[model samples]
Target: MTGDVRGTGDGRERRNTEIVLTAMRELFHEKDLTALDRYWAEPYTQHSPRMASGLAMLRAAVPTLVGFSWEARRTAAQGDLVFTHSLVHGWGPGPVVIVDVFRLEGGRIVEHWDVVQDHVPAAETASGNPMV
Candidate 1:
């Protein structure tokens, strides 16, 4: 919020966005779960309904997801909150479009919430628009 979003200066929100992007790349995309130690903070809070709310629980769940991957399309941040829109694969019947919200403290993720929907190909949708 410290710089003009449309200008050339390095905005604070842009830095926050980079932090989230780096975490996502190291943890979900690269399958390096240990990166969580550096990127995620606990006592963690998860608002995803099905998942538990501690870092240990999150750790246990990650490896269970075989062949899982996240491909981030874009990210935006405001204050301590950053959200990403992405295509997540291997967790659902097909590729799912996901918007993930993260609350970061001291540059580490402390809480999370997400909305997900099953992906429908462009031709199958009434608007014929891309999902991401």
Candidate 2:
């Protein structure tokens, strides 16, 4: 995935966003839940209905992610906010398309919001474009 970070200020914030997202991908793909502490804040706020608000809750849910595969399709950043569009295969009955937005403070992810939709077969879509 490619991300274009633009701003007149130094690229520190953009870099930080990239770092956090990269760590997130690693945590999911590698199943290294402990790595969350390095990229996320202690009292993380979760906006996803399925998840509780806290880093510990995320850690506890790691085991269920074992068979899932997360692939980042694109990323974008502005100021302290970073957004990612990704796909999660083997998550449920079919692959899911997910868009996640993260808020960062002091280089740590403090808040998150996400939207998930199940991938539809090409035959079911009017445009026939793949979801991811």
Candidate 3:
């Protein structure tokens, strides 16, 4: 939140970061599918092995995704790419840490990738460190 996107400078980078944040909040937290129209671009490329094909398949699966919410931990942007580190809930029995990278074109997200890991409670880990 303390990055260029929140306030620093370079309007384009700032705008792109803002777009990604709103899109994630609306889609993941609010579970508002309408965000797709406002924030996503067609011919979308999804790199995650969990999903198939392109935009249409993702669109089809959106409604089936439920009970989960996103808590953004960190955000950064360089040019058209925005990287977000977030904590997710209800996707499984416990929380997950997700590092997502999105590519935007003309202000709409056109490509996406993510790494998801089950959050390990501090008591369970040798280092006693929180994943976030």
Best candidate, lDDT: 3
The lDDT values for all models are 0.79, 0.78, 0.80
lDDT (10s digit) by residue, model 2, range 17-132: 57766777667778787679788886789999988999888788776775787777777777788888887887677899888888888888899999999988777888987776
TM-score of 3: 0.85
**Candidate 2 wrongly placed segments (more than 4 Å):** 1-10
The predictions' CA RMSDs to the true structure, in order, are 4.4, 2.4, 2.7
What's the lDDT for residue 67 in model 3?
A: 76
Model 3: lDDT equals 0.80
Return the TM-score for each candidate structure. 0.87, 0.86, 0.85
Ranking by lDDT: 3, 1, 2
Clashes of each: 0, 0, 0
Which candidate, 1 or 3, has the higher lDDT?
A: 3
* Tens digit of per-residue lDDT, candidate 1, span 28-63: 667678888988998889999888898887678777
Error of 2 at 5 (Å): 7.2
Cα shift from native, residue 83, model 3 (Å): 0.5
Error of 1 at 56 (Å): 1.1
Residues 46-77, candidate 3: write the lDDT tens digits: 89888765667756766776777777777888
TM-score (C-alpha, index-matched) for candidate 2? 0.86
2 or 3, greater by lDDT: 3
